[model samples]
Target: MSEHVLPQTELEAWGTDVQVVVCETCDWRFVLPAETSLPRCPHCFGTELELLSGEVSELPYVAPPEQAVPFAVSEAQLTGGIETFAKGIPLPPKDLNPAALRARLQAIYLPRWWVDAEVAALWQAEVGFDYEVVSHQERYSDTVGGWQARKVHEGRVRWEPRAGRLRRTYENVMAPALEAEKALRAQFGDYDVTRARPYHVDMVRRAPVRLPDRVPAVAWADAEMALRRRAGDECRQAAKGDHIREYRWQPAYPKRNWTLLLLPAYTTYYLDDEQRPQPVLIHGQTGRVIGMRKASLKRAQRIALILGLMALIIFVLSSISLLAVAVAPPLLVLGGIGLLVGMVLGLSALAPLIVVWRFNRPRRRPQER
Candidate 1:
């Protein structure tokens, strides 16, 4: 593993009064206001949380964030989004509704590492320039009744070897700050980091900020990869080539600056049929919602009971009609129809339960890290 030690200049004490709390279940650490009372882990709904006390420097990444993306979605939009999400669920749980989810919604800022570095490297590559070649071919045409010459232009590239030393500064190359960032991105997709505004203490004074678990040492590898990609693109531009191949570089970082860029998100939970919390995450900007949609087995059972009772009533009426057939022969047809209808209704009574069972069937989902 590559290790990038933080310089003394990069370490700073926490600016806002906050405490670090970690979820025992998910191992997610968050920085929240000291007075905030958290009943459960926002990410996993785990109730086992431990409050940690330590100096800022003892934390893996101590510097405060420089920028953050604010919640662009309004309350009405959030409510509508949740409503739309609930609409897709079949026999939704009683607690899983727009009002409940919106009530429990908590603002959270996810962490991403923003790195600025001055890189110096020796690079080599084969640069290719586009060229056109003209050629003539013979073609036969029925109208001409003779072989005619056809001209063709073919595009090709001319390769040349080139090498040079590169000294450049790259800024704000973002990398994941949390181990679960991949899962989060898979859930919420990517954010437009360029739209981020300068962060302020008030922006996250009440909201919890998820702290970085993938510290600079582990994140530096991803940063280095991003830097190399930037370096290659610059080299290709410098060579003024349409294509480049076998690009290789040896880079050294003389100066590095590390900072944080927080992205906005919201988390809420609702109880399923089993009374377990099912977390719902919403994108702060786009208002996209993602969560496990569960059907209410209790509701399904109640519907089945009602249907079964109706079927039983129909069967009793059919039995009375059959007995009346002893006196009136015309009642025989009515009694048979009633019996058939009653049987059909009884079979249909199981439909709701079957649908609910299918809807609530367990499936694999990405585990929160």
Candidate 2:
């Protein structure tokens, strides 16, 4: 891997008392206090690691982010999201209610790296321009008993071979800062990154900030791909073509700049049957919730028990009615009614039992990304 250095200005912000560690297994970087013991990488749970011993200049600390999209979701919005999530659960755990979930809300900022690159490359592609062709079709209508000419417009593309040299600079092309960045983006959906404001310490004071784990060297390939895509888009626009295909380029990035960008989110957890924490993530900008929708087996069982008791009571009454029928003919009518009612109640009991079974059915757990 090519070595990349952090700007001198960013290094001055770090205190000498802080220790930076990198996991050898996953290449995850973490910043800790000097006295703290090293912990496994949270993403991959990698144990094998090495600690760095050098001046700040020798370390590969990414510069702190300059701008961030602050949390736009209000407390009311978050509550609404939780309530919506809890609405249809058959038998939700007591701890999974809106109030309980709201109490555990935690703010977090996830990191993404933005890269700027100046590139000089020779590129070639088949550019396609769109055109419309008009054709006439002859059709016979049974009602009219006549042939009619129908005109139809069909869209077509004209392709031409083109070759050119591209010398341009692409600014703030995005790259992942974490291994699961793509999954996170898919979960949260897109946000207006342009709305980000200059980063302020107070904005993230109470929230936990996730530092970048994917270094620039590892992320450079993604950056280059993004740049090439941008170049292809620009090329199509320049050629006055609707599409480009079979595009290839040999490019050299003469200059590159890397900076961190933080995105806001809320993270919390609810315990599952095994008392293991199951995470629920809500988008800070959109209030979108993503997590497992779990049903409580204990709650389902309680409901099933109540229904079973109701069915048993009806069955016992029917048995008593059968004995009463021996006394008189009129009593026989009562016995028959009791039998019918008991059968209905017994059938009704299955509804709750089915609910219990459905709620307790095994399901795939939600994955964290």
Candidate 3:
């Protein structure tokens, strides 16, 4: 990641006095002005919100973002995603369709921390240099009684011990700003940070921005690893070596800076059969949807019931035809056909019922790391 420094005035704009509110139902955090009117929880739309007593600056594990990727997905694009998701469901709920889902869409910004640092380190490694050796091969053919000579080139690596003491600056090493960073990434994939613009309050208007849950202390380990990888690349380039192996380094970061980066996403939920909210997430830049596909129990049951009635009617007609076989000998063939048809219809009726059962069964999704 490359560094883009914000001007002093822009940095100071994020330092305004703000109040933090926590939702009692969903535990979602919201940051607003101290005197601003309270709003319902954006995640669950619950009215129960509590104001944190202390100042926003004293809030633990929360920091303002320095950059953000503004939402690029329009409402029309999100409707397309929802429509695609609504398809292929065996018995979908009425509210789970595209229009209803789109109505509940909420813009959200996820967090990633970018760290900048100045480091001084002494590093040592075995650097490998590539070389080619040419050798001549002689072959004798029995038919010709002649010798043939061929040249072969083989590639080889030469390893040499290299050591260096260096002072360097590394910037924009990204680390997860959220505790559930892995799950969020698995849910929404990666955001294009190259398109990230300087953080402005206008970009987040009417949107819920998630506070950073991973503090700098916890995130520093990841940042350090990124920095070391960059240092290794620099060392290889400096030595003019093809590869570096068994690299070791002792580094001290004399100065370090951490800034938050906000990634755009859209969140919404649909009510399931039991009227429980099931959350859905969509990428703001790319129209990707991630969530559970719920089956409607009522619809499944209704279809099963209709099929059951048809099976019953077929069974009754077959029974009546079988009785008529005794009255007329020619009717025996008709009776046999009716019996066969009834059995097929009866078996087909079980399909809808089985589908309902399978769709309603509890399924366990893979746990995200």
Score each candidate by Cα lDDT. Answer: 0.81, 0.72, 0.75
| Candidates in descending TM-score order | 2, 1, 3
At residue 152, what lDDT does model 2 achieve? 97
Give the per-residue lDDT of model 3 (tens digit) for 263-364.
888777788877877777788888788887867877767776777777777778777877887787777777777777777776776776678677657667
TM-scores for all predictions: 0.80, 0.81, 0.77
Order of quality (lDDT): 1, 3, 2
lDDT score, residue 188, model 3?
66
Tens digit per residue, CA lDDT, model 1, 80-99? 88887778667888998888
In candidate 3, which residue ranges exceed 4 Å CA deviation? Answer: 1-19, 24-26, 32-58, 129-158, 295-298, 328-334, 350-369
Backbone Cα, N, C clashes tallied per candidate: 0, 0, 0
RMSD of each: 4.8, 5.3, 5.8
Steric clash pairs (candidate 1) = none
Winner by lDDT: 1
Winner on TM-score between 1 and 3 is 1
Worst 10 residues of 3 by lDDT: 2-11
